[model samples]
Target: MPDAYSNIHLIVRWLHVIAGITWIGHLYFFNFVNVPLQGSLDDATKKAVNPQLMPRALWWFRWGAMITLLAGLTLFVLTYFYTPGAGFGATSLLMDADGITDRAMWILFGMLLGIIMWFNVWFVIWPIQKKLLTGKVPADQVPAARKKALLASRINTFLSGPMLFGMLAPAHYGTMSFGALLLALGLGVLAIWFSIKSSSRVGKPA
Candidate 1:
């Protein structure tokens, strides 16, 4: 039978996936759909629409990020420290005298990206979004604020591909060449581009 730790990890992993979907979905919506939509709107329309629209979306986006980060960290700890017994034990892989294994390296790499994304969500994107929503940013500063938030969100968007690969690849990624890794990373970014482009074509000629 799977150990309790494994069982718990599975549950948290599931939660992490669900929360991640929510987080990334809204992120894509913001970058792919909302930004362009916002651009076309008159000042009055934006005033009418954005206040109602962004808050509800941001509610999901920010909290989805929070839950995903928490669950992912929990899942990482359980996997990293305790996984040594059934998998390559953390003692051998992470705490050993020589160095860590590729799997551990990948997991840590993914976790780093996730932490950065989470930080961006809380500290950068959300703060600017709040200001814009509440009209706190000065008129001259509004463009810069929007740019900062967009840059942060786009960074998260691009990183997501590699982050997801890092999380999943370690299972089967044993000793893979760095070239292939780089290739996969490129594909991840391209996938983001493709998805965002596809979003524009999806239904609603209105």
Candidate 2:
């Protein structure tokens, strides 16, 4: 039974990693490459290029996000709640059921961040992008709509690094301190900020 559960975990982890890569790859492409490219194009060029490009990319992006989320939740259930042959695993609490372990706290933090990112992708960014793609947004509201999506996407990006820390810290480092998780999150957001600033300088006079 343990072997079976292990196999399931391994397979789902693979799926989660693959889907996460696809989702985050598209996200970075849009942020670092497409945004600048869009600014350089005239309206006619945008009309010709955007329609042809956005839908295909977004299809994979959104679906990847969905798969990653589902896989991640499955893993959480398997790891923290039900353990084959071990009955109630983490929930068994070993010593304390009501107490939150450091590892659990970190994993929960990451899960929260990932869930929020998923919500933003599906509910906020996708809707706004759909409106833009379909020419459904009023001209006066287009910029605001675009801004809203961009902001949500940026927030996700900022959260990604810290989320990784939250997810990985427990597994690798074990018993991560709360302060350490907070520091990792802070650094993660700072890394995103630096990347954005540095990107603004590329392909320009040095």
Error of model 2, residue 39, in angstroms: 1.2
At residue 15, give the lDDT of candidate 1. 98
Please list the residue runs of candidate 2 whose C-alpha ends up more than 4 Å from where it truly belongs after superposition. 86-98, 203-206
lDDT score, residue 197, model 1?
A: 75
Tens-digit per-residue lDDT, 1-206, candidate 2:
46777898899889988999999888878887778778778999998888999999999989999999999988788777886776765654222555876777778888898899999999999999998998999999999999999999999989888988887875776566767977888899888788777665676644
Error of 1 at 33 (Å): 1.3
For all predicted structures, in order, the TM-scores are 0.86, 0.90
Query: TM-score of the candidate numbered 1?
Result: 0.86
Native RMSD of candidate 1 (Å): 2.9
Question: Using alpha carbons, what is the TM-score of model 2?
Answer: 0.90
Model 2: per-residue Cα lDDT at residue 116? 94
Where does candidate 1 stray beyond 4 Å?
Answer: 1-3, 83-98, 197-206
Task: Output the lDDT of residue 189, model 1.
Answer: 91
